[model samples]
Target chain A: MGKIKILNPGLLSTIQDGGRFGYQQYGMPVAGAMDLHSLQLANWCVRNPAHEACIEATILGPTIEFQSDTYIAISGATIQPFVNEQAINMNAGIKVRAGDVLSFGSIQTGCRIYIAIAGGFDIPELMESKSTYLRGNLGGFEGRALKAGDELEIADYERRLKGVVPEELIPNYSNFTEIRITSGAEIKRFTMDGVKTFLCSVYSISPQSDRMGYRLSGQKIEHANGADIISSGIVTGAIQVPGHGEPIIMMSDHQTVGGYTKIAQVISVDLPLLGQMKPGDQIKFKEVNLDQAQQLLLERNQWLKQHGIE
Target chain B: MIEYIPSGDSAFLVKFGNEISEEINRKVRAYFIALSNKKLEGIIECVPSYTDLMVLYDPLKIQYKSLLKELKILAENISEIEIPEAKTVEIPVCYGGNFGEDMDAVIAHTGLREQEIIEKHSQNSYLVYMLGFTPGFCYLGGMDKSIATPRKEVPSQKILAGSVGLAAEQTGIYPIESPGGWQIIGRTPYRLFDPNRKPEFLLQAGDYLKFYPISEEEYYKLNEND
Candidate 1:
């Protein structure tokens, strides 16, 4: 099988796909790529189906050597992906020769970068996905982040895949972002004044944040009754408030259930932005009705379909 | 009251009740099984907790109102839904000493002798409320309040998998190594979660779990096979 040999596994690089579902019933988390949109965008360049397994790297990235010729694409975060010190363009398919070394430079914009090959990663699928759940040591290239000396096989495919994301379709990864969220199921659990304060607050992403959830520190919102709730299902992007009154936004690797009261859920369209945010980035919440939030999701999907990349 | 609450754009939170009990959880499991049997279009996944069943769906395939309408119809006669009989699983736990670091703390907190604490913990059967918080981590209910203790002020940075612990009125097993505040009383030899194995999880919701005390030698002897 064709392979990519890892030379240096930068910060936190792992294989990920759409997500592992249907297993959440058994207490499993739906671990997937932090930025599904960017993963899909990179897959688009490689002519693979959307949601194919790809390498997800944090702000820093890995140095890898191609063991065979294939088309590769880089998307999200300007990591300055280079082949033998020669820079490659982002969002476009680039051809590589056997033994060519690909390394990354400092992150220029986004917090995460997705790297996709022509035929996707050839890791064994567990629970119908290649995404890694680090906590459980399940799935994805031996259930953990990539390391130096690990050889990852890629599916066999041949094509100088030609694709490029349109300017408007690219994500804007500014330090300060305004995210839109809909009221959570337990919205009334918090004081009306608390809800208003959340909308008006500008929170800085806490340093402790990771794939499981993003911790935000800002104004402490008041709970009408208390912060505790009967443990219930927690969806990705749900902003849960605990006794501390601080909000924790669930992310791709969020657990199946939580006991804290969730104040709101970030709209689906805006979720990808959370994946690209780094520690200390300022975020402010905006309110959108459920109808408007769903509309935004549909519009985003429509755009992807319109571009023949759905 | 059965209420349909808003979650996010792609899902709906259908709450059965506001509290955790066998009666309410049975309803959750019944609906989970019912929704599973429906093979409903656009429904991605259904996760049942103590009192809520969150149905995640694909907005591109079905709208919120349409899915809500379908869910209401299915829920109208939900209590009548037949659920599978509960399965009883017996777990052998070795309590106190190194296997249970917080055993002394628990004994002090409850003011009970070591043997009494062990007997009380193992004697009562706990209902598997839900399998969550971590993969294959069973949310057990019905721990004897005599041994009930509050969670530690500072959660351990890493609690090993298969550690049986107590928090408030609950006793749970850590299916995987994770940071937790539960007071550890014992450790189990059983691997509650093994991804490579068929079935993956040792316990599921709608099951009964009874713990039996085991000697340290027996714990290592049983664990050696795995």
Candidate 2:
């Protein structure tokens, strides 16, 4: 079996794929990579399936020692990925011999980086996924983040071929981003002033944000009624408003149900931008109709297919 | 009246009512069972909550408007949907000790004696509204308001699995160790969530859960037996 030995597990790294779906009814969250587009691109660089599990490294990355020759690609964050002490171009497949050391330097941009290896990470698949849900202690490597000296097994592949992800597809992880949103079920619950405040004001990402939610601190939007509502199913990117008037953007690891009133849902096409945002980043929401939001999603899928990445 | 709205690009929210009630819950379960039997193309899964159902689907295979139309038809005959009989599950709980770290806080807030609190808590059967917040965690309703308490000012960093807690007007069980703000009153020895098990979760939505008190020694005995 081919393997990679961890020498220095950077700030935080976990295994993720598409996500754990079809289990939200059982109180299970669909934990997966924050940025699905980047993960898919990384997998494409290795000629693997789109859902293959990869390593999601935070601002800092890990130092890994490969035990066998394989093809690998780095995407998302502009982490200066190096093999054997030399920098390598990201978004392009790179071949390495056994005993080669792979490491990363300072992050050039973005908060999370993805590394996809040939045949993907051969971790135990839970609920048909290898993504890690940290709170539940399920999936991924021992159901937790990677640590130094932990051995990870990669799927064994005989022939390693070079692949490329077009340069234009790479995203610029800007600190200030404009996120698009569609009105939510409870969109009418907010007063006109509240709606205006939400749309016009800039919100800074709170430090207490995580995979479960991104709490944004900005001008308090007054609601017509109280913020409490009947507990209902919450989708990813749902922007919930609690009684305190702060907005919380649900992410991939969001709970299956929540009682807070939701004002808007971030457009599916802009979720990758939200995923790459770090604490203290600024975000301004732009309102779009449901048709426009759905159209954007369709366009994204079509683009991915056109590039042969999905 | 039932209304289906787009939750996002890939899912739709099927809302049954504006408030939480057994009648609404039954409708959610009925429709969930009925929809699951449909095996609709592109329909991934349906999650039943207190007053709504989240129908996740693959937009590539089925359009949201088309799925909404199908759901509207299904909602028309929801009451006629045949749901399985609700199962009564008995859980043994050990009250007030190291296991229930926040037991004192609960007693202080309720002004009821420890035994009275336990009796009131264990008397009525709780309806499992849904399993959410964490794996195998059940959001139980029908707790007697006499002993109801608010969540802690600050959430604990870690609460043990199987710990039974009460917050606001609800009682719940933590399936895994995680951060929470509930006032714990007891612990059940039975495992609520086990990934190795066939169903993974011990209790599902629409199940009735009854609690019985046990001695601390008996709690350990049950754990040892498992």
Candidate 3:
């Protein structure tokens, strides 16, 4: 068995996979990689399965010492990665020998970083996922963020596959992002002016935001009626505006149901871009119909398939 | 008539009504079970709530139009689908002491004695309209308004698991420790969430919940048993 000792766990680092499915009905939040596309690409670089667990390093990244020769890959946020004092290329496989020190520099762009190993994390699945639900305290590295002195075992893999991801596939996370969205179920509950304000107004991410949801600080969305809805079913990406009117975009770990008026849902293709947004970052919503939303998703899937990244 | 609204690219809500009602919830529960049993391709899961059921699907496998058509046809036979009987789960609570942080506040608001408040809270059975907000946390219906207490002005940052409380006209249990505003009055030792158990949650939507008074000593015993 291979091991990696955490020298310094920066910001918030946790192990994640595709997420726990088939359990939302039990009020379980599906805790998964915030930027699923990045997670998949990182796994592809290391030749791991699409759903294999990876370390999700937020804004800041971790410093670690490798304990065995293993092939690894780094993707997502633009954090400079180094192996034994030498800088390494991201979205590509690099071989690390025992006692090699792997560390990362301050993030230049985006808000999260994903690191994947060839064989995957030797973490047991809880509720069929290695993803950590910190609030629920379930799964992944004791269901919490990694800290200094933590040692984790890695799975074994004999051969390292070619891990060059196409240049075009690498995402360039920008300062300000335009998130595409489809009108939500409670759109009718919002006035025309309210809807327009939501589409046109620029919002900044609140520092309070996390895996559960991104609370946006912007123009208060005027409810056609009162904002309260009978607590109903909700999904990730659904933008709910509470009585206070600040739109909160549900993220990867959103609860199954909620009571606020949901005005829009960020499209699947743009969710990755939303995931990369950090506190104080600016975002504007662009409305797209359901057809356009699904079309974008199809194109993304097709692109991933063509590049052998799926 | 059932209304279908798009939740996102991959999901939609099958809404039975705009308000909360047992009849509407029954329909939501029935359709939730029916759609799951149908096992339609591309459909991921169905989450039943107070008045609507959210159907999550794969956008790549099936488009919204085709899924809507399929859902419309399924609605025709929805009434025929029998919703399973709600299990009457008994939850024991140790009331009005150290276990309840906001017990005094609740007593003051209701103008009722501690024992009287517990008797009123436990004497009635409540309907589990849904399980949400957090895992195993249920939205229970039919709390007596006389004993209803407004939520705390400032919500607590940390509420222990199994804390039973009243908020507005609703009385429910906090399945897991979470930040909440409920006027807590009691605590239960029963584990509501055990991933290793056959059912991860203690209750589901459509389940009946009944609370009974227990001594603080009994709470310790039950807690140790779990």
Q: Which candidate number would show the highest lDDT if scored against the true structure?
A: 1
Q: By TM-score, is 2 or 3 better?
A: 3
Interface RMSD of 2: 1.2
TM-score of chain B of each: 0.90, 0.92, 0.92
Candidate 2 lDDT at A64 equals 96
Better candidate by DockQ, 1 or 2 = 1
Error of 2 at B169 (Å): 3.9
DockQ of each: 0.74, 0.67, 0.78
- Identify the leading candidate in terms of TM-score: 3
Write one digit per residue (lDDT tens) for candidate 1, span A254-278. 9999999989999999988989999
For candidate 3, chain B by itself scores a TM value of: 0.92
lDDT of 3 by residue, A176-233 (tens): 8999998988899999999999989999999999999999999999999999988888
Ranking by lDDT: 1, 3, 2
lDDT of 2 by residue, B1-226 (tens): 7888787677888888888799889788888888999899999877889988889888778877788889998888766777788898999999988878888998899899999999999999999988887788888988999999999999999888888999998898888877899999899998988876777778988889999999999999897223
Better of 1 and 2 by lDDT: 1
> Per-residue error at A298 for model 2, in Å?
2.1
Q: Give the worst 10-residue stretch by lDDT in candidate 3 chain A.
A: A156-165
Q: Look at candidate 3 and give me any clashing residue pairs.
A: none
Error of 2 at B23 (Å): 1.0
| lDDT score of residue B120 within candidate 2 | 98
